[model samples]
Target: MMVKQERAARTRQALIRAAAEVFTEEGFALASLATISRRAGVSRGALHFHFDNKKVLADAVERQAADVVARMTGEAEAAGDALDALVAATHALMSRLASDIVVRAGFELCGGPTRNTGAALRWQWQVWVEGTLDRAEREGLLAEGVSSARVAPAIVAATVGFEVLGARDPEWLSEERVARFWELMLPRLVAVAR
Candidate 1:
């Protein structure tokens, strides 16, 4: 029974990975279960057994990707202070989006022109940033002139832009590019140590 359960788990993961790749390349409306199953090297029956349809498969992919993002940020929280966590999360997110197909697909599906699943991932990211910045403000970590309310949206927009542009050119999500962003913004955002 354990062997059968492990096999099923592997098959389910395979389907989710294949579905994420298809969704990323073809958009939600254009992606088909047949294509995903073929990409996974699984039978249609096997695919159906794992997921009821493309939407379900996409949800699975998004769920996995969301978990990754949550864990990444959660880990970031342990790095240091709120400002440090924000920095760590931004770098980690860029790296993840570059390397993880499911993460890239989740961000894509959030605002894909072909789908109406809502901007769940983007909202999730924005909320985290906003909260982190709020913490920074309360902790006296932010520059005197920096307002969390003012900077949070800009930070969210820039990161989301990176995610969108990185879909076409990987350089947009590169460590150097992300570092450059922080290099320019950090000096203004971080409070000087007294």
Candidate 2:
């Protein structure tokens, strides 16, 4: 029983990993369950046993991705400056997007039109950023004229743009590119006192 349970867990993980790669490369609409199963090196029966359909598999991928993002950004909260934490979180996330297939797929899947999942990952990210920026404002990390409401969309748009552009030229996901973005934006974003 233990061995069977362990095998089942491994198979599930394999399916998720395979799905992430397929979804990342082909998008949710184009990704095929057969391809994902093949990539996972598991039988179609095993894939079905684990995930009833492509949507379920994609959901699993999205859930895993959310966890990844949560962990990635969770560290940023430890910083003394909320704005700095947001910047660090952005850097960490961009770096993850560059190197982690799962993270890229999760961000991609969040925007997929086919899925009706409530509050897509992108929205969740935007909300989180908005909250952090609000906190920064309270902490006086923001410029005199800068408002979290104003900055939230810009940050979200730029990050999403990086994810989209990274699809074509991976260099867009690099830390250097992300750093350059912050370098230009930060001076305008930080308070005069900061």
Candidate 3:
């Protein structure tokens, strides 16, 4: 029984990974269950037993990806300086997007046209960015003219843009790329460090 339960867990994870890949490549509308099953090397019956439909599978993928984002952001929140934490978090996200197919696919799925349902992952990131910026503001890290309200959207847009662009060209996900972005943007967002 234990072995059977363990196998079931593994099969479920395999389906999630396979679905993420298909959704990433084909988008939600075009991705089919057959392709995902084949990718997972599992029988149709097995796939159905685990996930009733493509949407459910995609949700699982998105949920798992959201967890990843939450963990990173939580770590960022633990830092003494919000600005440094934000920078570290962005690098972490770019690094994850570059190496983890699931994370990339999940981010894309969030605002996908065909899905047209929700963007929980992106929303989570946006909220985290806003909170961090607000913290930075309270700490008086922000430049004189900048406010968290004004800067949060721009930061979220830039990070999301990196994920979108990184999908086509990995260079966009490079540490150097994010560092350059921060180098240019951070000066404008924050005051000189004490």
TM-score of each model, in listed order: 0.97, 0.93, 0.95
Query: lDDT tens digits, residues 104-159, model 2?
Result: 88878877777777647777788789999999988888888899999989999998
Question: Under the 3 Å rule for N, CA and C atoms, how many clashes does model 3 have?
Answer: 0
lDDT by residue (70-135, candidate 1, tens digit) is: 999999999999989999999999999999999999988878766677788999999999999999
> Which scores higher on lDDT, 2 or 3?
3
The whole-model lDDT of each prediction reads 0.92, 0.88, 0.91
Superposed Cα deviation of residue 179, candidate 3 (Å): 0.2
Model 3: per-residue lDDT, tens digit, 78-189?
7759999999999999999999888988988888887765788888989999999999999999999899999999999999999889999999999999999999998898
Q: Candidate 2 has what TM-score?
A: 0.93
RMSD of each: 0.9, 1.5, 1.2
Top lDDT prediction, candidate number: 1
lDDT of 2 at 14: 94
Candidate order (TM-score): 1, 3, 2
Residue pairs clashing in model 3 are none
Per-candidate count of clashing residue pairs (backbone under 3 Å): 0, 0, 0
Q: Which stretches of candidate 3 lie above 4 Å from their native place?
A: none
Q: What ranking emerges by lDDT with the best candidate at the front?
A: 1, 3, 2
